[model samples]
Target: MGDGPDLIGRRLREVRAWRGLSLRATAELAGLSASYLSRIERGERPVERRSTVEALAGALRVAPTELTGRPVAPHTPGESEGHAAVEDLRGALRDIELDAVTPESTGGLRTLPELRHDVDRAAAASFACDYRCLGAVLPDLLPRVWAHAGRIDGARTLLIECLFHAFYLAKDLGYRDVGWSIAGHLHRAAEATDDPAWVAIADYMRAEAMVGAHARTRALEAVVRSADALTPDAGPAGQAYGMLRLSAALQSAATGAVDVVPDYLAEAADISRHTGDGNFGGQHFGPRNVAVWRVAMAVEVGEIDRVPELAEAVDVEALPLGRRAWFLMDVGRGLAAQRGRETVAVDTLRQAEELAPQLVHANPFVRETVADLLRRARRDAGGRELRGIAYRMGMGA
Candidate 1:
């Protein structure tokens, strides 16, 4: 594979140049320093935060994907299959949105229980980060759910679950537009159910989808509002409420509002104490999940030093595969940023990849960090391992 231009940095420089804006001007617009933006464009720094990418995109009047290079080309057969499935999903979503789905084309309508089983299977695949299996299941399952949604009780709930699977799959695969479209479908389906809690869940998903685009402030505000509207008790609604607080915490950290981060975390922690561990709405909330998000939030806000302490408190073995891998990824990212910790960083990242190859490889930050490590690798020392990781991430040897 060709050594492509530095992913986000190269795109940022090109877009800035095309717009005929000086580095200082763009920096001013994006509320960043000229020197910092210069380093980012020169590939001396990786654009690690989604908030930063969104800010730059806003300054340039472009979608965040323009900088992130999302919907990144499939590098493996499994990824290729996943991308192909997205095309089918796109058509299905379009047909559903337009009320054009035909029963004749969608095969016989599936019973609500059968549809629920299919959604459960998809959720399991998602929790395992098995995008290929999820991709295989959703294209056919979605249309059938849509068919049954109007005719059966509780079918719309199943449809919402299918949309959740679709949303996460698309987002994980870097199809931001598809994810956003699916989020819209999710919001509508939840609204149709007339449950404020489900609507709150959809609102949380929508905020997440928005973070991939522009409007970081809007996303954060929406989450906070939705979270405030819900009462924190024990059960699915409580879990949803806790998750919304977690989302707000991360978004705040992303925007450098560190002071408020702890408040949100504390609130979520309290709610988790009541709710206990849960898989409600596939969110995996509770004390353990909240602990995982604490580590993630620390990483997001550049509190790299706290990551080790926060990470140590969580029992990774108890978390789902995807959560475990992501927490490890965050740990790796934190370790990689510290001086004299390259070896540990590499090992942690490798562990994450070993647990879930799809999640690790799909992460742009991991690819960038591995490339940076490879650049500094001594031939006799860490070079071999870094090369292996780079090759697996399709960054070349």
Candidate 2:
């Protein structure tokens, strides 16, 4: 959070200069005003939204990570170990991709119940935001699940779940390539089950994995199509359908389809009313979660003023630690974008970190926000707090 050379604004400036485009030219390309872009380049404003980052990256002809600084260097020993696990997972997934996941390859054939138990543990670790534990479990579990997926009932479903864990672990750690690979495996596994519900879930996960890839429109279309393919009713299918709608809402917001966001949100809200609070396939879909997604979409489009009211409608305590932490992170992001709200933003982010330190620390947006806050903080108690949060994020004081 100190005067880091790789801040988004600085990166943007560097890219623009290298592209030989004037500030106004780049602004027009990104659909932004010159003054706004100028302020951003000067570090007077923070790039707080993914949509903005995507737009700028598109204009600059660079990957979104080029600006967001993703796949960030590990800051602690635990983080380093978590990163190291990615390679092991990659190898396991590669074995599956190559059709090499035999009994011998997996070390031994495992019972369905045993594999299910391992998948459940991985899911639990994911919900708890225990990245180290999640990372440790998946590299060994995935190939084993694949070995049993052919002859055993429910083995494919378990395989899908393990792939879900792998996808999130890779994605959360900023390994988008690994996430995309896992998503492909997930889709194939879900299709093997011949269940439309599982297919829809995989589609949603694929769309999520597409985030920051500068494919916002395609991601939105995929999510909406999958959501529409499902019949809205009570139970797990309904819950999965509702999550798709929520994801669609977020995608719509990210792509600047402002009018469509409400429709998606409203549909998801109605679906949630029927599903109630349920964790179907690890997605905590309910009224509270729908409300949380509303806050997130609002934040995406820079509707900071509406975040508090939308957040008030959500009971975040009812969510898993991961979801709860994300909601708090979104609230912190919204607060950070508003003038005179630095102290509250730091406090909210601290709350998120308290709930899930690994998740909070690993988020590129949170780190960027903390850095921006530190740059603008007054030299007082608030500055000290900002520095503390920044330090925890591994942004340095």
What Cα-based lDDT does every candidate model obtain?
A: 0.84, 0.84
Top-TM-score structure, candidate number? 2
Candidate 1's residue-wise lDDT over 1-397, tens digit each?
A: 1245367778888999999999999999988999999988877776666667878998898988777777677779987888888898998988887887755668876677777888889988988888899889999888888888888899888989889989988988788889989999899999999888899899989988875333667788999999888877799889999999998987787666779999999999999999999987778899999999988888788888998899999999998999999999989988888877888888899999888887788787777677667656678556677677778877776
**Error in Å for residue 241 of model 1:** 0.7
lDDT of 2 by residue, 230-292 (tens): 886798789889989888887877777778888989998998889899887788888888888
Native-to-model Cα distance after best TM-score fit, residue 99 in candidate 2, in Å: 1.7
| TM-score of every model versus the real structure | 0.95, 0.96
Clashing pairs in 1: none
- Model 2 accuracy (lDDT, Cα): 0.84
Error of 1 at 220 (Å): 1.4
Candidate 1 stretches with Cα past 4 Å from truth are 1-5, 212-214
Cα deviation at 101, candidate 1, in Å, is 2.1
